[model samples]
Target: MSNYPKTALVINCGSSSVKFAVLDPTDGHVFLNGIGEALGLEDARISWKHSGGEKTETPLGAGAGHDKALAFLVNNILADDKALLDSIVACGHRIVQGGDIYSQPTLIDDEVEENIKKVIPFAPLHNPAHLLGIDAARENFPNIPHVAVFDTAFHQTMPPKAYRYAIPEEFYTDLHLRKYGAHGTSHMFIAQEAAKMLGKPLEETCLITCHMGNGASVSAVKNGKCVDTSMGLTPLDGLIMGTRCGSIDPSVVFFLCERLHKTPQEVEKIFNKESGMMAVSGVSSDFRPIVAGIQEGNERCTLALQMYAYRLAKFIASYYVPLGHVDAIVFSGGVGENGPTTRKYVCSELEEAFGIKIDNDANYKARVYMGVDHQVISKPDSSVKLFVIATNEELMIARSAMQFVK
Candidate 1:
């Protein structure tokens, strides 16, 4: 066995926080993982843990941001172990938007950085934070290769018919206003894992991957490539999310502005931050609380769960047009991996329409928290198989980074 270092450092920076992990690209084993949150606030802090070790935390002091967090990662976290630091062969950055230019993971360079910057308007809050992290990581670890893994890259395979909006030609031609799905990394990871669990070659497998989380999307992966996805030009166009309303009438915007006398920005906020499960359930956006409310006989919570499942099932059935025959339906992401009740509700809706005979016992048991990474939750006689596969975007990013390291 080669003892040479084969680890990749994965960085996911947000507007005010940084999430990082050092893991082996080969086995998906995390060596260290941490988060630095509340940057530029009064109580900025970072917490981390070595593999199989107790977690440790430290305050980064006020006004600290990406640079200070990354500096702490190098100076205090990895400094004591030279071997660990040396083992890092690549740095993988999670970029939320790549616009139309990149279809795959690209090695980070000055030009690549500029391209990312150009897409800032598409991912205003996320891309800038990613750039900050990239710059900081480059300064902190100048020796290793850095790679950008875009969240929209996988969905770039969609045909024009699937991605195009029915607006004026000049809108798309001038401003590039078309569908660009989110959760590409998760969908890609789930498709690959679903193929493995089904014991089929990736190129021969067809899947409808439902990444159900606070922010959710459904994707049609036909023969190892994304043929269509639920999300559009922005995540706001997709399935009803935790806070964002999905796929509403276009005229509602004008209604809110003209009749309600609301500004564009306020209407935007209403769509993005004041709707979906939170607004429908009158409960927390987190699924747990909503589920609890259902148990307590809260009618709105029940309605919310019904709406969520219905929307998900509708998307799954609609994907049948893109993928003629699905080999499996994969459930992934935070809610998909753990929300058994949600899975049950959705599967019940799909059973009659799609001939999916889900095994209730198996579905409830297939949870990542229970150490079940892969589970076949369908009966053998079912026409379509069902699976719950845990997603690992960090591992996917690490593997992508490793591909360019040599």
Candidate 2:
């Protein structure tokens, strides 16, 4: 790898997919990106695309997990690609959980990697996946300095009163049961990006960033640090998501296990995999069809949409305090950036309280494109400015990686 400040590779790992991007940190230009998925099953398809329109597609087997995928990236994606290999300076990893430490973008050392591994229990779904990616990178490109940009990193500033649970006092100091929010990388990216779009300094802006994807969360960022967020100890503690039940009552667990004769695992399965929009609508987990059903007068679909929008609006309203006054409500991620209908409903619900008005015409006109982008869907004179900006977590990770090399 070249010792340079301009180039860094960013890796993002999911339960079944690993996405990568190569970027020039000097002026924030992305050169290449790719994804490998359909893991743990046969005929896994790995695809790589360069900024120059060159495409490479390979077919691997079910066991070609994240490590193997990275091997593919290094061997093929970087082999014939002279520019990528020549300029590659450092690597960055997108880690999903940081537990209590909420470490900022840090140079990934043995201790730091082990620290991430320790939180696997808290983030069973994501931390293990993150470790796999980290290990893969370590094995494939041992020379490249790596940095971990935590999904929880940006939220470490949350006050004890806001993040702590009311259970036992020891839970805070001992077990780390307090809220260690996730998707903070996305929140951090969009919030700072919004500051630029608004022509305001990051330290002067207060933002509530709503990251709506298969996983979802809303963070109240005050003066560039997260003070309150919808996500709690785990990603399960927020607004409703694809199949995950977000923020259910603690009593519901007892109701399922004690009263319904379901085991803890069985009850957990219900909440983590069998609930939310899928259970409520009885339709696909995707919001596209669910949103489509709204026009056709489908009751279940309508209720699902209502639940999603209402919860989002509720959280957005609650974040007003931590933000002091609330300068803007920034939306990003899959559903947040693309779902204008949902954005409309969410903003309209708070129109009276926040004096925010989304221009329906502008929202519907927004397109789906990558990189950083913004749209002010609010009335020209709205007090609480509403913005929908595309997120770039991987690029943020890349910049962190460059710092690691430095």
The C-alpha lDDT values of all candidates are 0.92, 0.84
lDDT of 2 by residue, 1-406 (tens): 3343458888888888888888887666777788998865687779988776887888867667888888888887788776667688798988888877656788778898889888888888788888888888888878889888888878888888898889988877778788888888889989998898788999999988999998899998888888998888888888999998899888999988888899988987888788888989889678899988988898999999889889999998888767769888888889889988888878878889878888889888764564337778777888877888888887788777777665
Mark the 10 consecutive residues where model 2 has the least summed lDDT: 365-374
Candidate 1 clashes between residue pairs 3 or more apart in a chain or in different chains: none
Off by over 4 Å in 2: 1-5, 370-372
| Model 1 agreement with the true structure over 1-406: per-residue lDDT tens digits | 1243579999999999999999999999998999999988889999999888999999999989999999999999989766788899899999999999999999999999999999898888899999999999999999999999999999999999999999999999999899999999999999998889888899999899999888999999999999999999888887888999988998999999999899988998998899999999999888999999999999999999999999999999999999998899999989999998899989899888778888989877888889879888898988889898889999999999999877
List TM-scores for all candidates, in order: 0.98, 0.94
Worst 10 residues of 1 by lDDT: 1-10
What global local distance difference test value does model 2 have?
0.84
